[model samples]
Structure formats: structure tokens, C-alpha cells
Target chain A: MNMKKEKQSGCGRSEDLVTYLYGEATPVESSDFERHLKACAECRDELTAFQSVRGTLRQWEMETVPPRIDIAIKPTFWQTVKELFAMTPVWGKLAFGGVGALALLALFNVSVTVGGGGVTFSAGWRPQPVQVVTPGTVPPVVNPVTPVTVRTTDEAAVRAIVAQLVRESEKRQAEQLDAKLVSLTSKLDNRQRAEFVKAVSQLKQDQRLHLASLIQENSRRGGPDLLDLIGQVQSASVEVEE
Target chain B: MQTLETTDMQLVEQTLGGEPDAFGVLVRRWERPIYSLAYRMIGSDEDARDVCQETFISAFRNLKSFRGESKFSSWLYRIAINCCHSRQRKQPQPDVSIDEQIEEYGLEPMDSRESVDDRLYRDQRAQLVRRALAALPHDMRQVIVMKEYEGLKFHEIAEVLGIPVSTVKTRLYTGLTYMRKRLEHVSDSL
Candidate 1:
């Protein structure tokens, strides 16, 4: 019975042997297990077999680790930017293109000065209306080279022209604003409200500066005062706020 | 040479600090153990290679999630073992193709410079050991591989497998017993 019991315990609890083999058993456990291993032929033989298996495993080397797979280093910042542009939505691309075209138009208008010649790209975005005399409207250019009898287009005509041009420009601007609104509202989480507020304030400041400069330029060019245009802009902003 | 001695955690910090090459250091250091574990678990060279690459890639991507809760190698082992499990599931069964079997046990002509007959004898012994191991259950195979080949401590194996150390010991003991029975002739010869 004593021999049977020892056999059962030895076979059932080889964890001590495993711990000792792996050098994990504590001092007492190690010494005790070492003594036991000296006497226990079965345990000693099993340890040897496990060791032999470990040796065999050492032989199974990865002949050559399929060439060090250097992770194609993550794209640089500019590459990430290029990827962002490439991934931008179609509406986003259109909005960017519209902004770019508007910037170019602003640069062109800033560069060219209206003189007493032909209409010189004065496609009516200027606050001061160019005195364009349509060939039919000019009453026959009697002097042939007398500057075609330049006359400021009537205020109603200019206002109508300006209103139409402003409407188209506003339409394009509204499309971009609508795109931005969709994007912003879709992402309207708690964190974005502060960003939205900052963005709006910055936009209003930019508009204030742009309109102030336009008012000054219009005054210098002997055009409409446009002081109420500022009020109109402020009131329109108030309407948006409401 | 300096990097060879750098600790895994120090390399990990370097990798996270934007020196991506540091990860390459970690890979070179750990690839052998990881590949050995994968090959022993799956019994296929190509699949093991796939698992090895995937393990490092995953570790790199999810490096931030590594909260230092365990040893870096244990964490890597966890990823690799998970990859093995996934690869096993995708296959109809873990079928060790003949080519992989030959490649897996094929002996190398290193410094020992054993004769052709000696190399063939060692190859046969290795093939027997691998077959015996492959016959064991997945849990038993993993515990044995980590403990025997990777030299992971019982607790480390437990941590890698997310089991109790007691369970690790039980599996290792049970697995060794199973391998002993299957490899009786080889064990007797040894």
C-alpha cells in the first residue's frame, strides 16, 4: 500500500519535477525534489526525456527567417497629407477647387486696375462698377476712337448686375458652406462644439477684415460708401445666429 | 551588439518614441523563438512564417495597447498563439503537408559537420519527435512548446496563455506523459 501510494503521488504530481527542471522551484522545493529525483528512477528518466526533446527542438531552426520583413516604414507626414487629399470625398474636392478658384480670382482682381479703356476683366465682382458701354447701348461711337463715350452703367443696371453676380457667388459659397455643415453636423460630438465656435469666430473676423478693406477700397475709388453693406452683413450674420 | 543586449522593454520604448528601426531590433531578437513556437504548434514552415510576420505586425500596430502588464515576450507569445489558433480554424484541419514535414525536420550542415548517415539519423529522430508532438492536443502542444523550446517559466507560460500556473503545470506534465508514450522507442534510445 505504501509503495502504491508513492507511485500514485509521484505520477500524479510531476509538477515539482517540472518546476525544478525549469529552475523555477524554490530552494526547499528544489532540494527536496533533487533528493526525490535521485531516488525516483521514473522522474529522473522523464527529466532526461524532456531534456532530450528540448535538445531536438533546438535543431529545428528557421533555416533563414524569410528576410527580415522591415515594415515598409509608415508613410511620412507629407505622404499622409497626399493620402488625405487622395481620399477626400468628391464634394470635398469640389469645395477645395471652388476655394482655390476664388483665391485666384481675388489675386487677379487685386493685380488688375480698371482704367479708361475696355472693361479689363471687370466681370463685376468689383464694388465700383466698371463703366461698360455695350456696343449697342453706346449710341454709335460717333468719334470712332473717343473711348466709346464711356458712361457708368446706371445704378439700377449696376445693382441688378451686382445682385446677379453676388447671387451666383453666394450660391457657390452656400454649396461649400452646406458641405462643411454636413461634415460638421455629422461629426457633432461633444468635443467638436468648441472647435466649431472657434472656427465661426475666426470666420466672422476674416469677413470683418475683408469687408472693411472693401469699404475702404470703394471709398478710395469714388464708389458707393457701402457703410450699410457692413450693417447688412452684420444683420445677415444675426439672422444666421437666430 | 549593443542592441543585442538592450532589454525588450527599452527597445519597445524606442519603437514607440518613433524610432521604428527599434522594432526591427525586437523582431531579430524574438523571431526565432516566435517562429519555433508557431512551427511546433502548426507543423508547417510557410504557415509558421506567416504567423511570425503577423505576430510582429500585430505587436507593432497594437504596441500602444501593451500596458506593460506582462513581459514583452509573453505579450508577443500571446499574439502568436492567437494567430496560430486563427490559422488552425481557417484550415479544414491542421494538415502538415509532406513538403513542410521534410523542411521542418531537414537537418542542417553546421559546425558539427556530421556525416550523411549521421545527418539522416538525426533527421529521423527529429521527425519522430515532431510527429509525437503534433499528435498532442493543442493546449498541451502550446504549453510544452513555450516551456520546452521557448524556455518560458511556468508562470510566464501561464501569463502568455492567460491561465493559472497550476493549469500550465498540469498541461506540461500531461503533455510530457503523452509524448513519452508516443516516443517510447526514441526515449528508450535516448
Candidate 2:
């Protein structure tokens, strides 16, 4: 028994004999552990206990299965693009490219229209009126020598012509006003622009009052006939102006 | 070198060669032990299943990078251990109340005394073991789980965890000693 005890102690190192009992020991360690277990009651009891613990642990099982996963393959850059294109049907590819081409074409059409400064509309058969600016109608070119005012002979005809001319002049004036406002806002210093805006606002208020007074005076004198004609003319002129 | 001899390089090579089914065979071979290790470590069936899935998925993704430096099972065990670590870190601290812990660990309470009392007692002892296992520190628990459930050698566990074999032995001894004491404590309480 003394020899057997010595043999057991020598064969299995108690340090990791527990691991050996669980079958985790190396082959050499397993051999020694088996030899040691046969001879020593103490070591053999320890092994049995460790084995029981291990057996109990083995009874524990996970109740569920893991989820399945597909590993994504990393494709080359060109292969990625190729795969993207491949995923698209032929008609879809054509549609994508076609939409891009259509966008470019629309952009080109807009550029051409902007460069020409006006849109051309076809009337199917007859050409619509294309108004030409008569030199007499255009404001004198801001030169000192050019007359600011001019005279006409036939009062009614002159009034009608002047009304037509005034309507045309006001339309041009409105376009110039828009352009001037844009330019002034962009170019003028802030203080100067503010002052200019105040002056222009005051002038518009004064002009509106003057026009109202004139309309009142004409209604008093002409018994609303002149006012009615002026109203009709103004309505007609607005449609043409637009 | 011995690890290289045991590593599943052949299986991996076969897997990479369009034999995806080869991996399923590997799964079938390792699943029970892997699942057992996960279940023992986490003490929750749901979390253990998650760890097992993540382990295989990670192993599959990094299969190409495995250079046969260690055994495939060791590598797989390492992945599973790391997964369990992360899972534990994410979990809120479990209630230390014995009843709560027992219930959370899936231990059913004993009812009327029956002829199956012996089997029930054994099951309760297993649950007690599991509680003791869960009570251990993360480092020691890892060594015990791998050694007991996964059956990794001291050197192999050390290799998987990248720790010294002596440290592994120390932890195993400490863990087992703790288990014995805890088991005795539970028995006395009953």
C-alpha cells in the first residue's frame, strides 16, 4: 500500500488531475492519470467526483438552434459594378441610361432658349403679331440733344395713339423697372439703395394719388362716359400687355 | 505543433472549395459540445444559443484567416468564449437571490415526493452545480467551462485563452474547490 501510494503520487500530478479526469489531459498525462487512479484511493475518489461534475455539466444543453447566416463575398470593385448592372434587367438599364440622356437633352433645350432670349411658339397656320418698337415710341436715348416731349395733331387719335404708346411704354417701363431693381439691389451700396427705394416709393404714392384725382375730375365733366371708355381701354390694354 | 496536427485545415480547405455542406458536417460534430459549453458558461438557454450561433458565424467568416497555428476546436472554443464574455458584459447583473437565480437558470422547484425523488435530487444537484459555476468569477468560470464541458486540455485551454498552463491549472483547482464548497453549502441549507 505504501509502494502503491508512492506510485500514485508519482504518476499523477494532483495539480491538473481533475482536468485529466474530464479527458482534457494530454496523452502522456492521461496514461499517468490512469496509472495513478488505479493505486491511490484519495486520487481515485477525486477523479470520480470530478468526473461526476463533468457528467452533470454535460447534461446541460442549449434549448435553441442558432440562426443561419450567409457570408457576404467581397467582390472586386469592377466586379461589384458588374454585379450591380447584372442585377438590373436590360430594359431597366436602358431606362436608367435613357432617363439620364433625356435630362441632358432637356438641359440643352433650356440653354438654347435662354441664349436666344425668347421662346418661339408655332400657331399651326398663321403667324401671331410680332410687335416692333417704333423709334418714335422708344424713349429718347438719354442724350442732351434729344427732345423729352413730342406733339400730336388729332386730339382723339392722339389720345388713342398716346394710350397705346403709353401702354407699350408702361410695359417696357415695367420690364426695365424689374431689371433696374435687380441691378440696383446687386450693385448699389446699402445706404444709397435704401435712399433710392424710399424716393421711388414716395413717387409711386404721389402718382397713384394724381391718377385718382384725374379719374374723379373726368367723371365729373364727361358724366361717366369718358370714365367708362377709359375703363374699357384699360381692360383691353391689360390683356394685350400680358 | 500538436495543435497544427489536430486543426481542421483539411475540413476548412474542403469548405472553401465550394463544399459548403462540409461545414454542416463540422457543425454537427461540434454542436453538442459547443452548445454544452455555452449553456454551462452563461446558464441561460437563450443566450447560450445566441453564443453558439455567433460562434459558428464568426468562425465561418474568419475561416480563411485561420492559419492552422492552433487546433480548430481550440480556435472555435476561443470564439465561443469571447462570445460568452461579450454576452455577459451586455447582460444586467443577475439577481443573487437563490430562488430567483435557480428559476432564471431553469431549475424547476421540487413538488410532491415521488419515486423519482432520486432523479429529482440529482437534477437539483446539477442545478446547484450550475449556480456555483455561475457564481465564479469570469476568468475562473471560463477555465472550468472549457475544461469540464468542452474537454479542452490545460495547455489547450491556455492556448485558447492565451494564458499560461499553470494559470489554467490554478483556476481549475480554485473553481473546483469553490464548487465543492458551494455544493456542500446548498446541501446543508436543504
Candidate 3:
């Protein structure tokens, strides 16, 4: 009964049985455990059982081959860039996000023009209303609520001044065009006259040469140059005979 | 090259010195033992393979953190064990069904030339042993596997597990005792 209790609830001696079974006990520990084992059937049986268990466990041979393990110590630079962007602080992300959003708004043609219309914010687009003024009436430039009407005399005077300015502008443009046309025409006439004079002089020179040749031919044929004419005929006849 | 490659510490230094192939040398050297350790601990070929991969990757990533206090193998075993624990936490497998116990441990069909009876008997006994080991508590199983299968010394197991040597021996004893009872029961059933 005492042995059973010691076996069931051991002192630190149980661990020695393990150390001894696995052969890890020191020589002194081994000799002491051996002495103890000679007396203790429990330790001996337990040692035997554990050895049997280890034997059974060792029978499991794993024939499975290990697959090759490759570690990429350095990730791709693109992945590094992604990690860098991912490490951005929340405020930085939000700031960049805001900038990106503004860029998107700009891409969508959302324009904010500060005009007399008190800041026009158009999404797609809305054209401003067009106004027409009669001949005697001077309307406001862009105001619809209040029309600043001028007296007839002022309106007429402004109209008269505008018409006068328009007439002066037209007259200046017409005069400029007329002077250009006249100068061009004069240049064309001078060029034509020079060409015509050259052509006439050339024609007269040719006519004079022809008349002199005619006269020389006439002189050779009958008028005091019969010797040259007889030589020409005789040379022609000799060539014909040869 | 064999003469030049002296030790794990040398490989580690070479790896740290921007020679990545040196790490490859280390991986090739240790992959099998680490894989075996993982397989024995988890009892699954596929998960063990994953654990092996994760262990090496973790080691390579944190190679600078290794203090050289333990053997490089012990340090690697520590990482592999941690990865197994993490994987267990992430995905707890269902208990091996009694009908599927043979399939669980057989892993691959081996020895086509053996008589059906002999193969069946051998595979059945192996499967029973595996079932028992699988049933062991994780801590005890870890100790048993390190001591019995991996042949790690008691102190090495202790160093890897970061436990006292007494604890390791105690765990080994308890684990072996439990395995004995389980095997006895299995033998009786057979």
C-alpha cells in the first residue's frame, strides 16, 4: 500500500525514471537510479513501458519529401513603393485624398468663375441670359433687376458718337484699301510697260536685221554684186554635180 | 565550396552580408529536418509543408534578431514550432474520424509488391500509433516528438521550448505514459 501511494503520488523520483529511460541521466544519477531501480518495481516497470512506447513511436517513418522552400528576402520594388504609400499617416492620406478629389473635380469641368454674377458655380454649364436694347434705349450691361435708363438726348448723343466713330473707322479702312489697290495697280502698270517696251525694242531690232539682210540679198542678186551671185550659183551647181 | 562553408554561423554571416544564395544554402541544409518536425507535430503533410515555408520565411525576415544563444537548428526549431502553434490557432482540424484514421496517417500508398495482408497489418498498426500520438496533449506531443523522433537532447528541447529541463523530462514521462495506455487499449481492441 505504501508503494502504491509512492507510485501514484511521487516525490521527484519519477522524473529520474524518464531521464534514465532516455539515457540522459548522469553516471552518478544513473548508478543511484540503478540502485533505486533494483528496489523499485514501479520505476522498473514504468521505465520498460516508456521504452516500449518510445520504440512504438519510433516506428513511424515519414517517407514524405519536403517541398523546396524559397524565401524572397527582397520584395519587388513596386511592392516596396506600395508599402511606402500604405505607411502614410491618416492625416497625410486625407490631405492627399483631398488633393486627388480636387483634381477629379477639375477633370469633370467644374469651373468656379468669379464674375459679376457673384461667383458662378456651374457643373455641366448654364449660359447667361442675353439682353437686347432698342435703338433709343440704353440698357444695363448684365443687371436684370434694375435697368439704368438714360434720357433720349444722352442716348441719341451716344448713338451719334458711336455712328460717327464707326463711319470714321470704315472711312479709314476704305482709304487704306483704296491706297493699297492703287499702289498695286500702279506697280502692275509699270511692270507691264517695262515688259512692253522691251518686247517692242526686241521686235524692232529683229525687223531691222531682217531688212538689212533683205537689202544685202537684193544687192547680191542684181544690184552691183553679180560677181558674188555668179560665185554662189556656180558653187551650188558644182555641189549638185558632185 | 565545402571547405569554404564551415558552419551555420558562417552561412548566417554570408546571408547578412548581402549574399542571398547563402540563405539558400541554409534553407537546403535544414528544410528536411524542419519539415519532419512540423509534420510530426501537426500530423498533416500539407499543413506541415506550409509551416516549414512560414518558418524559413520568418527566420529569413528576422535573421537579424537571432542572438546566437542557441544552436541555429534549435532557433529554427523554435520558429517552426511557433508557426505550427500559430497555424493550429488559425485552423483547428477536426478530430480524425475512426473510419479515416488509416487514410490520415498512410499519407501515400507504399510497397505495391507487398501482400495485402502484410501491408494492411503494418499500415493499421502505424495508423493506431499515429492516432495515439495525435490524441496526446499538444505540449506533451511536442516534447515527445522533439525527444523521440527529432533526437533532440533534453536540454536542446528545453532550449527550443524555453522551458526548464525538468519540465521537459516530466512532459516526456507523462507523454510516454499516456501513449502506453493508449497503445495498450489499441492492442486490446485489435
Candidate 4:
């Protein structure tokens, strides 16, 4: 029990020593710990050991740093626009969209006509007069709202724009595809012509060899030519029949 | 633009004010200590560099939210420690070899007039210390590294680790005691 008590005292003293070494202990507590440290050899030894460990750790270092470039926050105009969109709340987006739609309807001169037969919706878009204001002007230019014409629905104009865009893209794609097809066709034509010429030359060479062999055979036999020989054989057969 | 006297908070402010290179100044300022902390924590040079870079990037991204409740360096330490925790979760800590440690950083000569045997002994002792440190539990190692290596105050360490000051003291005491025994054993083994 006495030894266990001493062990606890040693643990507590070491804890206090660490607190003192790190300068966390109060002045009074440090004084008391310092007095105790003078009396306690075990605590002093532990302190030395910890300091040694720290010295070893201090040896570990970052010798060199790999070069790295800092990424600059350079937002493009589109990126700024995107950031604005991202920061906007859902209600704000809806409000802006509603206002834009109302302005678009007003700009297009959209109208609804309720007649005896049925109700008809129509719109006709006309260019509105724009008040141009230069910088540093005393008063800004303001154009009064012009009277709107009751026209049909403006969906046709929007559809026309969309369709035109689609047609232009399709036309560009078709041009690219047609160019590729033409190149491929020319390549195929060249290859086929070369192959045809090669085949024709081969056939002509075979025919010349056959003719030459026939001439050689006729000369070796020392008899009439092939055609004459056949003619004579035909005549003799005819005579036999007669 | 930067000067040698620019503080981390000043660099952060400049970075927030549309000067991107200012953050690089902060990075250069704290890079070594941060890298050393990471290298000691994770025991891998590559991972330590990655953590150091990541810590700076995280600090940059979260700069707007910083309320200056703590020291800027302490905040960086917190972020770095958190990063080390995240890395620890993603991968197991591999046992670092003495050769690898030597290859990464050659042993420091303790004395100019030391003989070859003394140099070898010192090198072996350094390795023994590292191995003993690596053998410690994670919390103990963290406390030891922060308190001993980083020279952070107990309260500052508590702030970084989000623990109480008493717990910091307890951990430090426990870690030192454990390391003392381990070092004794390592000395005997060598």
C-alpha cells in the first residue's frame, strides 16, 4: 500500500511536471512543482527523457517543398453568370422568370379574341423603339410605351427560331457527312480502277501465253495450222458420211 | 504582392479580396510546419505533401467562413488534423521502415567529432524513437506530435483536437510515459 501510494505520487508529479514544462501551470502551481521537482529525482529524469524525445522529433523536418502553382480565382463572364444563378434562391428565380414571361407577352402583342364561333389566341411581334442613353448625359432618354396591336400567339415566332437553329445545325452536320462520303467514294473508285486494270492485264498476259503455245505446237508438228487442220478433219468426216 | 512580414490572416484577407497569390504566401508560410506535422502523423512523404496541399486548399475554400475565433495557425492545425483523420479512415497506416525514413531524410549528425560507431548508434537511436512513436495509439501519437513536435500549448492542442485541456494533459502524460517505456525496450533490443 505504501509503494502504491508512492507510485501514484510519482504519476501525479510527472503530470504536474508536464503541465509546468508546457507553461500551462499557474505561477503558484509552478513554484510548488519546482520545489517538488528539486526533491523528486524520478520527475526530473522523466522531464529529461521527454525533452530528449522532443529533440529527436525536432530533427524530423520538411527539407524541400515541391513547386506548386496557386490556382487563381478568375471567373469568366459566363462563370459569373453561373455563380449568380447558383446563388439565386428558388423563389427569386421564379419571380424573375414570371417577370420575363410577362414582358415577353407584352412585347409580342399577344391577344385573345372571344368571338361568336370560338376564342382565338394570336400574337404578332414588332420591334419597339429603344431609347439610347449615352454616358455622362444630364437626363436619361425615356421612350413612352407605344399602343399594342391585338395579334395572334407568338409561339410561331419562337418555334421558327428554334427550328432555324435546328436546321442550321443539321445542315452543318450534313455538309460534314457529305464531305466524308465524297472522299470515301473517290478512294473506293481509285482502288477499283486499279484493281480492274490489274485484272485486265493479267487476262491479256494469259491469252498471249496460250497463243504462243499454239504457234509453238504447230511449228513442232510441221503440219498445217490449227484452223486448217480442223477444217480438213471436218471435210473428211463429211465425205465419209456421203 | 507579399512581404516577409505578412501574417496568415493578412494573406487570407488579400486572397479574399481578389488577390489569389496571397494564399500562396500563406501556403509558403505554413507549408513546412504543416508538412512536418502530416509526415509525422501519416509517416508517408507523398501522403504528407498531399495532406499539406489539401489543408491549404481547404483553408482557402473555407476562408470566408472563418470568424477568427481561434488563431489562424490553430485553425490550420485543426484542418490538417481533420485531413489526417480522413486519410486514416480511407487507408490503413502502413508500418514505416527505417530504410524508408533514412532514404527520405538522412540521419542528422549529432556531433561533428562523433566516431562512426557513435553515428551508427545515433542513427539507430533515431530509428528506435520513430518506431516507438509509430507503435503508439493514434490519440497518444497525435497528442505527442502536437505537444512535443508542434510546440502547441495544451489549451491550443485542445482547441485543435476539440478536447478539454485536462484531457490534453492526460493524453500527453500517458503518451510520454508509454514512449519512455517503449524507448527503453527499443534500446535494449538494439
Best candidate per TM-score, number? Answer: 3
lDDT of 4: 0.70
The predicted structure with the larger DockQ, 1 or 3, is 3
What are the TM values for chain B, all candidates?
A: 0.82, 0.81, 0.84, 0.80
Q: Indicate whether candidate 1 or candidate 4 has the larger DockQ.
A: 1
> Model 4 shows how many backbone clashes?
6
Q: Which structure is stronger by TM-score: 3 or 4?
A: 3
TM-score list, all predictions: 0.52, 0.46, 0.54, 0.52
Give one digit per residue, the lDDT tens place, for model 2 in A1-242: 11111112233465757556556678988887688778778777666665555555554443345334333445457756666888999999999899988786655542221112233222222223222334568743644575343221123343455577789999999999999999887776675656544543544444446546656877787655433444544565457559
TM-score of 3: 0.54
Q: Per-residue lDDT of B53-115 in model 4, one digit per residue for the tens?
A: 889878888999887888899999999998998998899665544345444544443443554
Q: Report the C-alpha lDDT of model 1 over B141-167, residue by residue, as the tens digit.
A: 898888877778888889999999987
What does the lDDT read for residue A188 in candidate 1? 69
- Candidate 1 per-residue lDDT over residues A1-242, each given as its tens digit: 11111112255547787787678889998888888888888888888886765565555544435445455568568766766888999999999999989898886554333433323344344545335534456545355455433324343454556667889999999999999998887776534555544534654775777667766877888875354555565676777789
- The runs of at least 3 residues in candidate 2 whose Cα sits more than 4 Å from the true structure, single-residue gaps closed, are A1-242, B1-7, B17-24, B94-123, B185-190
- Candidate 3: pairs in clash: none
Write down the TM-score of model 1's second chain.
0.82
- Expressed as tens digits, the lDDT of each residue in B43-96 for candidate 2 is 887777788888888898888888888888888889999999998888855636
Best by lDDT: 3
Clashes of each: 0, 0, 0, 6
Clashing pairs in 1: none
